[model samples]
Target: MEILKLTEKNIQDEHICCAISDKKCADGYQKKKDWLKTEFKNGYNFQKVDVRGKVFIEYVPIESSWLPLVGKNFMVINCFWVSGQFKGHGNGKKLLQQCIKDSKEKGMDGIVAISSDKKRPFMTDPKFLKYQGFEIVDEAPPFFKLWGIKTNPKAEFPKIMESAKSGTCPDKKGITAYYSNTCPFTDYYTNQVLREYAEKKNIPLTINHISSKADGQKMPIPWIINSVFYKGELVSLEMKVERHLDKLI
Candidate 1:
């Protein structure tokens, strides 16, 4: 299968992996594209398979990454997804190899990604990452982990910033959500769907948009796509629905 690299020239015409035909996330999709456009200048790379399915990988220089990770000369994987019929087809490996190659070519120390001890929604699978030779470099709170494969043995290992380790937001009351257009579903889910759900349930909700890299780095959680904190502690990172909220609240 051929790999398509999204550059400033072709990104406008390409369909990013997730929410390909999702109407509800149309605005969020465009916003994610806008966000990518800005990051591309900072050495962000997004590549996907030639097929019309959710099979893609996106990475950037760690310094330009929004996650609160501290590393020098490393490439931070923002997202890596392979789903549907694409699974078990080696498409995921191909995309990952491309990222590894690109990072090595750029003289980066290594490549790192946000994952967890186990499978979790919207997180890189730790097992898969481990199979590909990445080792746990740092960890945070309940289960968040940073995984990496270093090309330079002497390079400093990446770590989650002190701010992200707390796993709790400063807002000590109500349901506070922080989000960014990093994913196509976040804007729609956080602003419209969840907002309406909270109102219907008579739950106080506050949504904050992490518009800039500086703001994102200050976020309490590494998963900036969507994070909901209840009474100062993290409740969930998944873009929750009414059914899910019923159990949590």
Candidate 2:
């Protein structure tokens, strides 16, 4: 079992035959093909796991800032899969190790994965994220956890978030703040300022921690307020924008 970078040659129709059902992954071939060209530019790490020429696993580096909240210029394992024939072969664990090795080789800080909980298999189990040393970073169920295969757990969450190159953003060319009810910075901002005013002072836009999907579906990402998002990009809004760096620092 070799965890390899997904090249244009190997990312094909059967790339994930054992990981996901043929029906589910059949449409992903083209998506992967498209991904090979666009993934790196978007500030993400995309790779596949192959067993004797059979590509069956994928690991995606996150394209967002939340991972940065983890101490080590961190990254999240966005997409991970392993073939059914290889289940319990320690392949999942091995694949993860390989990813970590690659991360260090690439000069990354460290990695965080949203893994499968103890309740189910690696793919669909919402609670499975705990197996890989990932902790619940926010109140949201599966999406807000912070993971690291070989990193510290007690480090403080960061206030200065260095954003990823790109990811899923609802707004185009404006900032999007995924504030969660559980995040302290998010709480401070929402309580103290006018919504639009924060957007103007910070640029991009501001989102209070609301019960809408627009805020964040997973972990309800309600913690950010002093962020500059240009059409969905989370950036450093301003020094005065963040309360932690402002009042606390």
Candidate 3:
């Protein structure tokens, strides 16, 4: 299978591997495409296999990363997915190697990715990353883990931002969601489904759309793209609106 790299010229018309046929996510899909167009200027890359499945990787330079991790001259993986029937076929390893090659060519210190203590939606499995030679360099509350593979022995290890270490939102009441255009599902969930659901329940809901890197850097959760907090405590980071609604009720 051929791997396609999305460029500014073709990104507008390309299917981004997620929300390919979901009419409900149409708005969010466009938002993600628009977001990628802007991030491309900031050294972001989105590559995926040419298949009708979610088998792709998205990455950017550490300096341009949206997450609250500090490191110099490294590449940060935002998303690495090889879902559906693509698993166990080495597609993931191939995609990951491409990122490593790109980072090496750019003379980066290494590559870093955010994972969790266990499997979670919107997060890569730490065990797979560990098997690929990544090691835990730092940890944040609520099971967020920073995984890194240093190309330079002397390079400083990446660490979670001080603000994110606590993993607790300031809003202690109602439903609060912090999301960004990084994921296509976020816009649909936050602006449409989730919002409507909350209103139907007569619950106060606050949705904060993270518009800049600085905003993401201060987010309590490492995975800030689509995190929901109930009563100031972190809840689901996944975009499953119905699942979240059940929890809320």
Candidate 4:
């Protein structure tokens, strides 16, 4: 299968591999496209398989990465996925290799990605990355792990921020969420569904839209893009059903 790279010039005409046919997420999709255009200026890259499915990888230099990690001359993978039927066809390997090749050509010291200790929603599988020669460089509370494969042995390993290490939100009395345009489902759920539900239930909700890399870096949740914290505890990383939110609250 041919792998297509998304450039600023071609992003509008291409499908971002997630929420391709979901009308509800159309606004979120456009928001992500706009976000991508800005990131492209900072050396971010987005590539996906030619097939019509969620098979893609997005990465950027650690200096410009949205995640709170400290490392120099390294590439940070924001998202890497090969979903559904695309899983067992070696597409994941090829996509990873492409990142590796690109990193090397750019004189990067290594590549790093965020994962979880167990299988979790909206996070890459640590076992798969481990099998691909990545080592656990650091870990944060609530099961977030930083995995890396260093081309240079002496390169500094990446670590999660101290704020995220606790996995506890300061606001302990309501539904607090930190989100961004990175995911297409976030805006719809947070803005419309979640707000309506919270209002109906008389629950105070605080939704923080992450607008910059700095906001993401300081987020209490390791996965800042779409994380919900209820009563000071990390609840979910993806949009949840009303029943789920009720239960969490």
TM-score to true structure, per model: 0.97, 0.47, 0.96, 0.97
lDDT of 4 by residue, 198-247 (tens): 89989889989999999998887667678877888877787875766767
For model 4, the superposed segments whose C-alpha errors exceed 4 Å read none
Clashing residue pairs in candidate 4 (N, C-alpha, C atoms within 3 angstroms): none
Candidate order by decreasing TM-score: 1, 4, 3, 2
Clashing pairs in 3: none
Pairs clashing within candidate 1:
none
For each candidate, the alpha-carbon lDDT, in order, equals: 0.88, 0.43, 0.88, 0.88
The superposed Cα distance between candidate 1 and the true structure at residue 236, in angstroms, equals 1.6
CA lDDT for candidate 1: 0.88
> Lowest summed lDDT over 10 consecutive residues: which window, candidate 1?
240-249
lDDT of 2 by residue, 80-169 (tens): 655456666776667667777776676565565542233332232344445565555432222233445444354443222323213334
Clashes of each: 0, 24, 0, 0
